[model samples]
Target: MSDDATPDATSERAAALGLTSPAAEEGAAGPVRFAVVGSGWRAEFFLRMAVLMPERFAVVGVVSRTAERGAEVTARWGTPTFRTVGELLAATDPELVVVSVPWDVTPVVTRELVEAGTPVLAETPPAPDAAGLRTLWEQVGASGLVQVAEHSPVMPAHAARHRLLQDGAIGQVTSVQISSTHMYHAVAVIRRLLGAGFEPVRITAQRFAAPLMNPRTRAGWTGDRDPVEASTILALLDLGEGRSAVYDFTDNQWHNPLRADRLLVRGSHGELLDDRVTRWLDGETTIDSPLVRSQSGIGQDLDGYDLQHLSFEGQVVYRNPFVGARLSDDDIAVATLLDRTGAWVRGQGEPPYPLAEGSQDHLISLAVEEAAGTGQPITTEREAWAG
Candidate 1:
C-alpha cells in the first residue's frame, strides 16, 4: 500500500491480506466476497482483479483439482486453495464464485455452485455447444443466479459506443461493423451495439485465408513461430427491422498488431467510425467530435498509467471505477462484472450479464461458424432460456 492510499484502499488491502484490521472479518462490509474455481490463465484475471481492486473484491479461496497446482497458486497469490468445490464451499463462505475453467468444465462447476445456492460469474462460451447450452439451461437456467463475464460489451471503448447509441446520438442505429475479437465475443458486442434482444436472426458467413505474422499472447511473444497464412471469418448478421451487423475477424486478431481495429456504427442520421463521430445536430447542421479519453499517471501525474474514463461531446459516458489500479480497459470491464455480480447478489442491482444473454450470443456465434463452414445462410431459433 502507498502512503497516499485512499481510505477504501487502506482498509481493503488490510482486509484482503488478513491484517489485524477491523474490516478483515469473514463478512466484511467493503469488498465483494467471492472465490474462483480453476487456476489457469483466465482464472488469473479474476485473481488480479481482486488484488488490484481489493475494496471491490475479495478472493476467499480457489478450488484447484490437483494439490500441486493448488500449492503453486497458494504460494504465488497467497490465496487459500481447496481440492474440490465441496471443500471450498465448506471452508469459505463466499457470496459468489467465478467459474473460469475450460468450456467443457464450465457447466459442471457452474451447476455445482448454483445447486449449492451460490451466485456464479461464469466465463465466456457458457457451454461447449448448443446441446450443452440447452442441457445446462435445463439444469440451472431458471435459477436466476448465473451471470457470464463477457467483458467485450462493457469494455471501455465499446461501452462508450454503446452509451452513445443508447442516447440516440446517432439517431436510430441501423448497423454495426466490428473487426475486433471473434466468434461469440464479437457477437456479444454486436448484439449490445445493435440493441438486439434475444431475437431470431439469420447469418451468412464465409472464411477467407491470408498470411500474417502471429505475435504475442497473455504470456509473452518471443517471435518463436513463423509467419503463416491465417484465416479470416466474415459473417453477416441479419438483425430484423433492417438492422444488421457485419462481423469480420482474422485468426489471432485479439493480439495481432497488424490488423487495426475498425468499428463503424451506422445510424439513420449519423455514423460513428472508431473514435470519430459524425452526426446531424439539425436539418442543416452536422457535428463531429472525437471520443476523448482521460488517462492519469502518464507524465506529470505520479499515480501511474490508468484509464480514467471516456467522454464524447463533453459528456462523460464511461468512467473507470477502479482508478489508479493500473488495469486495462478489458480488466476494468471484468472488475465491473465482479462488482456488479456482487451487487446483484446483495439485491443492490440487476443481474449483470444474465445466462440467457450469453447463451443467445453463443447461439448466434455457433450459427455463424456453421454458416461459414457450410456456405449457407443459417437461421437462429429461440432457446429454452430465451425470453
Candidate 2:
C-alpha cells in the first residue's frame, strides 16, 4: 500500500460496502474476506500470505476459468473455487479481490469487482496497454471504487530507498543507471525514485519479438504472440536535477540465463552501486556497505539468486541487513501493503499503491517499449505519479 491520501468519497464508498472494518465498528470481529481471481503462480503467493498470516488475510474464494486449475488450487489450499466472477462473488462477496489473471483479461475481473464496489489489489501490469488501463479508469469513475497495484517498489525497498535519499545517505540531486530484462519492475523503481506520477507521455519507439510459447504453455497462454525475450531503454524527461534512472531490457535467458541487476548513483561527492545499495563518500571512501548473499534458493529466481559480498573503503566489510530480517521479498512487500490496508480499514490511513501510480508504471513501460521499438528517447515530460 502507498502512503497516498484516500479521499472521503473513496473512503465512504469502501466503508459502506462493508469492504472492511471501520475503527468504530470493530466490535464484530471476523476475518476480512478476500478472493483470488487467478490461480496461477502469483495466486499461490497471495494464498501463501493468507496461510502465513491467517489473522490478517483470508482466502474467502478463488476464481479460475479452467475447472482443472481451480480444483487444483482449491484441493491444495482447502478453499472454495469458482469458474466465474459472478459465482465467486456470489459465494464469498470478498472485501478485497486479488486479480492475478492474464494482463488482457484482468480488466474484465477488475470491472466486475469495481462494479460490485470491492476494494481491489490487482496483480502487476494491471492492463496490457494504455487503452486497457483507460477501461479501468473509466469503470472506477463510473462507479467510484478503490484499487491498488501489486508492484513491489511501492513497498519498503522503495520506501526505505526514498527515505534514505531524502536523509542524504548518498546525497541528492543527481543521476542513476538501472538495467533490467523486465520492464515493469524497472519502470516502477524509476517512477518511485523520480517522484513522477503515473501516465506515460508520448513515447517514441517500437517493439521487437520472437517465437513466444513452449510445451509448458500453449499458444492460448501468450495471445499466440512470439518474442519471449525483449530489450528496452528508458530515459526520463525534463531532467533538471534530483535523479535520473536509466533502464535496459534484454532477451529472456532461456538457455543462456543470467539475472543482472545493477544500480549506480552519481553524486556531487561519490556514488553507490548495485542491489547491495552500498554507499560511497568522497570518491574513495565507503560509508555503509553490507555483505551480499551467498545462499541459493530453489525455483525462487528464474536464475538462482545470490547477493555478492560488497566491500567498503577498500577493506571494511558490512553486515547483511537481511541476515535476520526473516522476510521474503514477496512477504516484505505484501505485508507492508497490508499494514497500510489495515490502517485504512481502521480509518487511520489510505491505500498505498494507487491507480495513478500503477498507471504511471504502465506508461513508463509503454514509453520504454516505444523507445526500444523506435530507437528514440521517449519523454514523460510531466506525467507525475500522483501518489
Candidate 3:
C-alpha cells in the first residue's frame, strides 16, 4: 500500500491508470431537480438518494399510476405526488423525469416523457423483449432524449477496473467473465469491459440444477433452512474480432452467501481477476496488485464508517463523490447514474448510458436464456438500434 506516497507520484500513477475522480470529471452542477414517474420498489432508490443528498438532488414530484399510490408516496416522503405525468409536469418543471415503472410499462412511460419533450432516465431493460425493444428504438432512438439507468459499469470496483482496461493496463481486453448480478446487469459490465458496441454475437448456453440453501434476499431472510433446488446458467458469447464474454448466473446469487460474485478480464498483456490484477511490466517482469479500498471509521478512525475511495498501486482509481452520504456501493452506483443523467440533461456531460446500449445488453441476455432453454446455440442479428 502506498498510503504515504507523495501527491505528485500518486497523481502520476493515477494518470497512468486513467483514473479521474468523478467530481473532477463532472464539475459541480448544483442540485438537480427531477421528478419520478413511478412509485415502485425501484423508484425508491431515486427517492432515497434525494433524501440522502438533498444538496445534490431534489425530487420535485412523483407521478404514480394511481391516486392511492401517489398518496402513499406523499405520506412517506412528504413530496407532492400526482396521478399522471402531465399533472406532475404542470406542477413542477423538473429538468428530467425518471421512468421506473414495470418492465412492460417502461417503454410506454419513456415514450410519453419523450413526446412531452422531457429528458428521461429510464430504468434498465428499456423494453420487455426483442420486438418491444426494436419498436421503442424506432420511436425514440434518434430523439437523443433517453438514457438508461445501467449502473453496473459505474460501480466503484467495476469502474476502477474499466478505467484500467481503458488505459491498456492489461493490453487489449480479449474476453470477460462475469458472475455477479443477473441478466442485463451482468451483460452491461461485460460489454463495457470488452468495449463491445452493438456487435453481432453467437451465444451457447446450458442450465444445471443443484440443491442449495437459500436464506437471504433483498427483503431479508426466509427462515426455511431446507436446501432447495437452484438453477445455474452458464453461457459463452462470441462477439467477433477476438472478443468474447462468459456469462454465469445462479438463482438468488445476488443475496445467497454461498455464492460469491466473480469477474475476470483477460487481455493480451495481462488479466484482472476480481480485485487483483496480474500484468506484464516488462519482458521478464510480471507484477500483481490488489485494488485497495479506504473505509472511514474503522477501529481507531471515527469518520463515521463510509467508503472513501478505491485505489490501485497508491493511485486513487475511483473516489466516492458522495463521501459522507454513507451509501452502499450499489447505492453509490445508482446515485452516480442519477447525477450523470442530470448533467446530460443539462448538456453538461455525456449521456450516462444510452438506451441503445441497454437494449443490446438485454437482447444478448435474452438470447442466453433462450439458448439454455432450447439447448441450442443462438446468434443475434443486427437490430434497428444498431444503426
Candidate 4:
C-alpha cells in the first residue's frame, strides 16, 4: 500500500475502501542494509531489487560456499561476496541476513544466525520435512528473531481480494479454492484469505497423471512438440467449523503455458471469482463488479509500462509501491516482503511473516503429499508453535 498522494487524497481513498486512514509517513530514514547467505537463483531476486531501488535497500555482502561462485556473484552484482557467514558478518554488520539456500540447509543457517544474535529472513518451507520443522521450531521458535519470506498474500490481485473480504463486501468468507500455486504456497494463500489461525485440519488428497504439452518454463520455450505425462494433485482441507479449502495443482503449473491460474473465494453473501465479485446488494438486486487494473504505457499513456493501482467499483484497493521499478507482479510481492522485513527490523512496523506461520503452512502441505501417497485421510496434531 504505497501512495504518492497528499494526506487528504490518501484519506479519500481509504474512505472509499471503508478503512480508516493510516498515519502519515515517518521521518526519512537511511536505506536498509542487508546481506545474502546464498548465491543461487533466489538470491538474485534480492540483488535485483536492490539494483532497481538503490535508495530503498542496500546489499552489504553475500556469502557463497565456493570461491568460484563468490567470484561470479561479485562480477555480476558488483557486491562483495564471501565464503562463509562468519566472514561476511565479520566484514560488515548487516541489519538483517537473508538465507536463500536449499531446504535442507535453511534451518542450519537460520540457527547459526539466530545464535549469533542476527535477525534472519528465511526462504520458504524453513525446513525439509515434518521432523525438521518441529526441531527447528523447538530450537528457534521462541527467539523472536526469525521471519519467513512468504509473498502470496501481498500479491496485487490477492491483496485487493483480501481488502474486499475484510471490508465485509461479501459477508464472511467461508471457503477458498486455489489452483494457482502448489503445496505450501497454495496453502499460504488459502489460510490468509480464510483468516484462519493455527487450528487443526483434516486433509484428504489424491494424485492423477495425464498427458499434457508444456511448451514453456521459467527458462523459456522447450521447443519439443510432444506431450508428456504430468501429475495433478487435488486435496480437500477441512478446517473445522464448516470452513474448508479446495487445493488443485498440476505439475509445473506455475510455468506451464497450458494451464492458467484460477482462484475462488466464497462467502455467506456472495462469491468472488477471480477478479469479478457477484453479490446481492439487496433482496431484489444483485451486482457484479470486476477488479480493474490501471497499467501505464498503454496507447498514449506515458508513465512507462508498470502497474499503478488496482480498483473495484471506482475505489482503489491496492497500489503499487514500486511503480517506477517496472517489476512483474511476482517480483512486486517479493519486493514487498523485503521492504516489510526491513521496516520490521528497524522497529518501524510489525513482523512481516513469522516462522510459526511458515511452519504451519508447510505442515499442512506435507500432509497433502502424504495423504495422496497413502490414500488415507490425515489429521494434523497440535505443535509446540501452536501456543
Candidate 5:
C-alpha cells in the first residue's frame, strides 16, 4: 500500500464489496482496485507493479480487443482480460483505470472512461496535439477524473531535487537546465521543479543533427555495429517571473550512455549541478553538498536489490517506497504515481498530477516542436482548460 493509504478503510471497503483483497486477508488495508486498458508493451509496467507489490495494487482485469491478446496477457500476468471497458465494469467495479495506448487513441479512451465516471491515469501526451487537448477539455476536463502518468517528477533523483527546491534549499529557483527525458516528459519535470504551475509562457527552440551510437533498452543492448544519425533539440522556455527553463535532448538519450543525463538548477542563492549543490549559507558563507544515494541487495546483502533513498547534507530527501519490489528508477517513479493516484481517488491525498497539468506540459511540448521547425519563438496562451 502507499504510505498515505489507510489500512482499515481499504480492508473495510474490500469486505463491504465482497472482494478478497490481499491486504484485507492480512488484516491490513486492501490494495487499490484498478484496471488497465490496452494490452500492449507499456501495459507491462502496470502488470509488473501489481505483481511486485500485491499489497499495494490489484488488477481487476485488462481490456483487450481480442481473445488472443487477452489470453496472452492472462497467461503471463494471471489476470483476467476483457474485450471492452463496459464488459469489465459490468462484472467488477474498479476505482481507477489506466490507459496505455497510442498517442491518438489516448483522448478517446480517456474520454469514454471519464464520461463513464471512472478515474483515469492516461499515458503521456494526453492528446496528440493542442486541438485534441482542447476537445478533451471541453468534453471532460472539469469532471475531475483524470491524471497523467508523467512520472519524471517523482523519479528518485528528480524527486530529491524538487524537495530541495520546495524546502528553499536553493532560495527560489530561477532557472532549470534539463537534458533528461524528451519532449513532454522533460517539460513536465521542468515545470514542476520550477513551480511554473501551468503559467503561460513563450518557447524558442532549435534542432541539430549528429551521428552517435544508440546503445541499450529495457530489452538489452542493440549489438548493431553502426552509428546512427541522431537529432538534438534545445528549447528555451520563458515561464514569466524570471522563472525560465532550458530543455535540451537528443534522440534515444534515455538509453544512450554516450550522452549522460545533465541537470542544472539555479536559484537566487545557489545552484545544483547534477548531484553537487553549491549555495550561500548565510549571505557571507558558501557551502557545498552532494545528493548521496543509497542502494542495497547487492553482493552479500540478503535484502534483495533495490534503490533505498536519496539524501543530502545528512537528510533523507527522497526514499523509495517499493524497496523490496526490485523496480528500476523509472518503474519506481511510475509506481509512486500509481500509489499516489490510489490515495487521491480515496480522498486521502492530493491529486497526483491532474489532467490540466498534463495538458499544459504537452501544450508546451507541442510549441517546442513547432518552434524548432519554424525557427521562431512560440508564445503560450491561456487555454479553456487552464485552472
Candidate 6:
C-alpha cells in the first residue's frame, strides 16, 4: 500500500463508485461528471474512457496515493488530481466515482465510498480472497448505495455463450463444462452461464511452484508480494445436474506463454468447441451457429480503449483466420452486454447484466476458492438467490 493509504481510508473524500442520472434538465454538454479514485494503471484506463467519450462522461477529479504519480496524471489529462480522497472531493463535485485501484485495496476503498454515499464500479475478484469478498458484499448490503461492477464478466465472449444457452440453442442445459484456469475469469464465466443459481457439488485444485516469464519476477514489477511468478493451479468444478467445468491454470508453460485462454460449452443439442464457438444441428457445418465472433478492434465504442491502450481489448481466445482478429461468440456476448450496461447507466433503459444477479457469481467464485484452499467440496444455496 502507498504511504497515505491510512488517511485515504479514513477520509470523507474517498467517494463510492456508482452511476446516477443527472436531472433530465442537466442535458447534453453537462456530461456524466465523474471522479476516478486512483491514478494507477487501471485508473488510467478510466481516464482514457473519459477522454474518449467526453460528450457522455467527464473525469473532473482524481485521487492517487503517490504525489508524483498523481501530479503526472493530472498534468497529462488536465484534471484536478489530489494526493488524498478528501482533497479530491473538496476540489470537485461529481455525480459518479470509478474505483480503479488494485485488488487488495478494493474492500477498504469500497467501504469508505459506500459510507460516503458514492456508487462504484470497483475492479474485480471483488477482493483478493473469499473472506475479503464476503466482507465487501456484506458492506454493500448494508450501505445500499455502492454498485459493484465487474468488467471481464462484461467482456463480450462470456455474454454470447450465456445467450446461446438461455435461448435454448442448447437444450435445457442438462450439464455445463468450462475449461480454464485463469481463476477470476473462469469462475465468473462459469457462474454467469450456469444462471448463478446452481450449487457446486465438488471442487479439486492442484498447484505446482513453476516459474512465470514476466516483468513481475524479472524486474520486481509492483512489489515483493506480487509473485515474481508461480505456476500450477488446475481445478475441476463438479456441479450437480450432470454439469461440470475443468479449470487449468498453471505457470509451468507461462515461462513461455502460449495461446493463453480457451472455453468450450457442450449441451444436449450442440457444442461450442474452442475459438470457433461453432455449434452443429445434427453435427453439420451448414447448421453452424450464425453469431459473428467479436475479436479485437471490432465495435470498440468507436474510440475508447483501443486507440488509448489504457485497457486490454481483445478476445479471450484467438482463433481468427486473420492475424490479430481473435473473434468468437463469447466475445460478442460480453461486448453486447457492456453496451447494454452503459446504456442503462445513462438512463436509456434497464441493464442486461442485473447487479443483483451478478452478485451471485461473486458468491459462487468465493465458494470455489474456498474449496480450492480446503481441498473439499462446498455447497451454495440455490434458493437463496431468488431475489
Best by TM-score: 4
lDDT for every model?
0.85, 0.57, 0.86, 0.87, 0.85, 0.53
* TM-score, predicted candidate 6 vs. hidden true structure: 0.68
lDDT of 6 by residue, 198-247 (tens): 45346666555654444342224433333344655566777776777776
- Write one digit per residue (lDDT tens) for candidate 5, span 1-387: 001112234344434433333321211447888899988888888866776667888887888888888877766666778888888877768989999989999999999998799999998989999999999998988899999999988899999999998998879899999997888899988988888876788999999998888777657798866788989999999999999999999988888778899999999989999999999898579999999998887799887677989999999999988766677898998889889999999888999999999999999999999999999999989897776
What candidate 3 gets wrong by more than 4 Å, as runs, is 1-29
lDDT of 4 by residue, 1-387 (tens): 111112223334334434332222333777678999998998888877766666677788888888777767765666778777887888888999999999999999999999999999999989999999999999999999999988888999999999999988889899999999988899999999999888999999999999999899889999979899999999999988889999999999999988999999999999999999998799799899999999998999986788999999999999998877778898899889888999999899999999999999999999999999998999999888898
Model 4 pairs in collision:
none
**Number of the top-ranking candidate, with lDDT as the measure:** 4
RMSD of each: 5.3, 10.6, 9.8, 8.5, 6.3, 9.3
Expressed as tens digits, the lDDT of each residue in 76-169 for candidate 1 is 5667888888988888899999999999999999999999999999999899999999999999998998999998898999988899989998
Candidate 1: stretches off by over 4 Å: 1-28, 224-226
> How many clashes would you count in candidate 6?
19
> Which ranges in model 5 have alpha carbons more than 4 Å from their true place?
1-29, 217-219
Which sections of candidate 6 miss by over 4 Å? Answer: 1-30, 174-181, 198-201, 209-230, 252-256, 277-286, 289-291, 294-347, 351-363, 380-387
Candidate 2 lDDT: 0.57
- Lowest lDDT sum, 10 consecutive residues, model 1, at 1-10
Q: Where does candidate 6 have its weakest 10-residue lDDT segment?
A: 304-313
Q: How many backbone clashes does candidate 1 have?
A: 0
